[model samples]
Target: MTEYWRVKVDPRMCVRTGLCAASAPQEFQLDERTGQGRATAEVLSASEEVLEVAESCPIEAISITDAESGKAVFPPDD
Candidate 1:
């Protein structure tokens, strides 16, 4: 089975920097009109690049955690 993870994006904290989109287009996308980035998908498998982007978020709006264990994987700890 393909294990899945949970990803969250704080819409209010998003600054529309486009970094998340640039880093993980498959997971994050920026709205051209609003200029805010949102998760394209909520559930995903463990992706190193995606986790890196979450940690790199300037506003720390992005958080990734294990779907089953609900433990924080990025941004230090849950």
Candidate 2:
């Protein structure tokens, strides 16, 4: 079975950078009005590309969690 993850982009932390959308167009997009990165969907199929996009966020505005467990997947817990 394919794993799924919950994705989120913190608007407060986002600097209107298009990195997430550029890196993972299918999973992220910049809201035209807000000009902030947003997840295409709250939950998406797990993939390395998505994780890389989250990691590539300069401000670390993007976060991912295991949809089933609600465990942090990126920006790993300290």
* Residue 44 local lDDT, model 1: 79
Best by TM-score: 2
Runs off by more than 4 Å, candidate 2: none
**Model 2: lDDT of residue 15:** 96
lDDT of 2 at 53: 93
- The positional error of residue 37 in candidate 2, measured at the CA in angstroms, is 0.5
- Please report, in order, the local distance difference test score of every candidate based on alpha carbons: 0.83, 0.91
The residue pairs found clashing in candidate 1 are none
- Best of the candidates, lDDT: 2
Worst 10 residues of 2 by lDDT: 1-10
Tens-place lDDT digits, model 2, residues 4-40: 9999999989999799998889999999999999999
